[model samples]
Target: MKLLLSLSVIIGAIVMASTLTCNVCNFRFLFVCIGSSSTISCTGNCSLTQTFAGSAPFFSQQACDTNCVSNTTTQKENVFGLNYVKTCCSTDLCNSGNSAKLSLSLGLSMLLLWLLKCV
Candidate 1:
């Protein structure tokens, strides 16, 4: 009986530590150039892309242009008996500017409290 109780406690602890969690993150980048055409590439959770073309309403037709690209990528790994989920992505792509590489951030779930409660 004592051994069974110990096993249960350990199992509960592990489960609590493995609980799922959520995270919120946002980022941006800027590019400058003579023209309004540019190419952007990202590996991961690529989400939104906004491009500004042609001259501004108030500016001349020869004015500058702009663009934005975004994406997302997810990866999983386990360490020290804990599991981790990594998500990364870009917010936007720019035109006529230098090429850029954006990486997304990873998040972890918190389950310590839940494990203790099970004990």
Candidate 2:
């Protein structure tokens, strides 16, 4: 029973830590923001990472391209060669790094943790 409880705790920690996080700036809050950047930890079906690249960036529940997985799009929000890009990915902070490399690292890290716990 003790071993089972310990394993449950470890697994719970892993799950909680594995939640999806995304760069959310000027989003969802009615109050004025103190900074231009912040993070949002999603829950349930809101499990996706969205990134918007533009001079005036914004995101919200309706603004987010929810259910977007492994997709990237480039759009022109202004004149000149400037482009406003919107990207979506799965996993924690995956929009910040190359998804392929991050996936490998995440897999390895989870494996390592499980292995450590076992040994």
Candidate 3:
């Protein structure tokens, strides 16, 4: 039982330490963001950026960014006629359509189950 518990803990730690993966895609024209067909892994965070003209989003890009920081920067519409917003997250496949919160929840649930079974 002790050995099983140690093995389960090690597996959980390895999963938590794995590199983050993010969707990679670029689209323009409207607010609709098509699902990405490709993905990339990064040591830092995944980034999703969207540009808006007036109040509507017109462009979006998502990919792995080693230097990404979680924040939003907006430009005055009068100066550039557009606004830009970038979101950075650190998690596996966080830049995809799936929510990071959901991923975290599932991971925790699995770990708890494993620990319970071990005990």
Candidate 4:
């Protein structure tokens, strides 16, 4: 019974670790967000969207999305001369400006150790 309880706890930890953490921010004129940026944890994917004015990037937003679709559209608004690119990824901190990679390595490592102890 104790072994089953330990296994359950390890499984729960792995599931919790898989939740996506995205950088949530809105910026204008540059992708390097001008002001403060924050992070959000969600069960879905992380999205990074950028809007362009003519050929120059003018706006950007990053957030946790439930049903984000990845795509690029050109000349979305001819009158406003606007275009956009959106990307969605299912990894922790994927929408952050920095290229740091966060994963369930620690959780998996713990699970492996627990299993070895059981054996």
User: RMSD of each candidate?
Assistant: 24.5, 18.2, 17.7, 18.5
Each model's lDDT comes to: 0.30, 0.47, 0.69, 0.72
Per-residue lDDT of model 1, residues 10-93, tens digit only: 998876664322111122233212123223333222332222222211111111112212322222233423222222233332
Model 2 bad stretches (over 4 Å): 1-19, 27-36, 43-65, 78-81, 97-119
Full candidate order by lDDT, most accurate first: 4, 3, 2, 1
TM-score for each candidate, following the candidate numbering: 0.22, 0.35, 0.56, 0.60
Question: What is the Cα-based lDDT of residue 40 in candidate 1?
Answer: 31
Error of model 2, residue 75, in angstroms: 1.3
Position 67, candidate 4: lDDT:
81
* Best by the TM-score measure: 4
Q: How much lDDT does candidate 1 score?
A: 0.30
- Using lDDT as the measure, the top candidate is 4
> Which stretches of candidate 4 lie above 4 Å from their native place?
1-11, 70-75, 98-119
Model 4 reaches what TM-score against the true structure?
0.60
Colliding residue pairs in candidate 3: none
Candidate closer to the true structure by TM-score (higher is better), 2 or 3 = 3
